[model samples]
Target: MSPSVTDHVVGRALSWADIPRLVELEGRLFADDAWSAPTWWAELAARPRRDYVALESDGELVGYAGLDLAGEVADVMTIAVAPEAQGRGLGGELLALMASRAREAGAAYLLLEVRDDNAGAKALYARAGFEVVTVRRRYYQPGDVDALVMRLRLRDERDGVGDTNG
Candidate 1:
């Protein structure tokens, strides 16, 4: 069952203490390309430039996301929700939080790469105003899935309108 807005969902900046759970969830969600604990520690070491957020319900981590901010572009490194929490808008919420953090850090655009076969994630990105900018062939190992690179303009180029409300 999907969680509703009234569910006891709580979101906050991810910290070192959450790395273990995040790694466990990562392995479960992306067995083939799961990041190792050392990699996650490196990411966290990067600090403010690489922002991450975690979502919890009933004191259990249910979702997490990370963004890499570089100059005017912010690339979404990862976003995942527990399988049991899939259809409850948690992914969208995480994306929004990442975008907001990126914008605050002066990013002008947000970018992400999704497996070509992930129709649901692709649909969500599309609904969130991301446009397919390019494709990287055989991006994912093991399965050898192609990657759809998507970009979302975070600011109106003409008027410099930013996504402060994200």
Candidate 2:
């Protein structure tokens, strides 16, 4: 069953055990230069990725994303929605939920990297209040693909967001 309209989409916290699915999705989405299972293993084993969550729908894993909560900033270390799940608004929903989690952690801003050629993801971030802040060349090795750095400012209680102290 779906969450209530006011409840927002829910993502299941994933463990290293979910590595197989994560790696599989990464390969399907990134093709030849995908992040290996070990990369995700490292992420899952890390403290920050402990909060990473996978979005499930129709009893299947349709998307996955993570947040690294550092003192006052949250980083979107990795996020991927399965090919069959792309084009749906699920990515944007997952982003919004991640941003909300950052805010809940007292993070003032969120940062992430997106492949420069990913216009769809860029647009998704833009609509979510993120802006292109910088660019890193040859960030994706082997393919020499560039990465666009982006950030989103989290809304505070003063900004009419959920009460920071509440």
Candidate 3:
């Protein structure tokens, strides 16, 4: 089924104050590999190079995503939507926001890694024009799940053309 817009979802920059709630959400969403509060602090410490945005619905946090930029490349560090909020297009909206932010930061391509078993996330990335580049064997620990590396060539802000790096 096609995803539908989540009109109540609003996006905003994630800050230090949100770490506690983010940690709680992380535990709920990712039990084994959930990021620690200290890790989130360190990621936020990276400043303009690392950007994180949180999504809220009716004033309650429902999703969050992070991007790491370096020169012409941008990596989607993490993205998650609450169980109750999944399939409502919040993930795509956050991803698109990251892509726009990456393009504005002069990124030519955006990259991400997803577990092979995550068919939903893989489909989401595929629908967003991302192509699988390679697979890292046993990338996810504790379960030995393979990681599918995906890339999306962002449109050049100046020329309105996609970057020529596959």
Candidate 4:
């Protein structure tokens, strides 16, 4: 079920202290594809180039997202919401936050790769104005899932052509 108005869901900057919990959530959310602690550590160590955000509901971590800002183009590194929080509007909220950050960082475009099998995620990206740029065959290993490379034109938002709010 979705959270109610009194749920107290909040978004904040992600920190090193939240890594352990993020790892736990990654395991549950991504299974074999989940990133390891060391990888997360490296990501955190990247500093200004990489930005991350965490979401909590009633003081408990429920979602997280990260972006890699690379001047003209910003890429979404990851986004995951706990199973219990799925289908709520939290994923969109997280996405919107990332898009806003990318815009503020002077990114002209936002890019992301989503597994083709993840219909929900694809739908979310589509709803946020991301268009499939290309498809990478069997990009995801073990299960051999295809990856859809998507891009959103953040530059258009500056000219009031598109929604940068994701």
RMSD of each: 1.9, 4.3, 3.5, 2.0
For residues 33-129, write the lDDT of model 2, one tens digit per residue: 5779878777778865346888876666768888898867789977788876676677877888788888888788889998877788889888887
The TM-score obtained by model 2 is 0.82
**Which ranges in model 1 have alpha carbons more than 4 Å from their true place?**
1-11, 163-165
Q: Order the candidates by lDDT, highest first.
A: 4, 3, 1, 2
Candidate scoring better on TM-score of 2 and 3 = 3
lDDT (C-alpha, whole model) for all candidates: 0.85, 0.76, 0.86, 0.87
TM-score of 1: 0.91
Q: Candidate 3 lDDT, tens digit per residue, 1-166? A: 2344334554588999999999998999886789999999999999788989889877888899999999789999999998888887778888888888888888888999999998999998998899999999999998999999999989757986765422
Name the lDDT value of residue 102 in candidate 4.
Answer: 91
lDDT of 4 by residue, 1-166 (tens): 4536247455588888998998899999996689889999999999789998888987889999999999999999999889988787888988998888898898888999999999999999999999999999999998999999999988764474545664
State the lDDT at 81 in candidate 1. 91
Winner on lDDT between 3 and 4 is 4
Candidate 1 lDDT, 69-117, residue by residue in tens: 8989999999999887888787888888878888878889999999999
lDDT of 1 at 56: 86
Task: List TM-score per model, in order.
Answer: 0.91, 0.82, 0.89, 0.92
Which candidate's TM-score is highest?
A: 4
Lowest summed lDDT across 10 adjacent residues in model 2 is found at 1-10
Candidate 1 global lDDT? 0.85
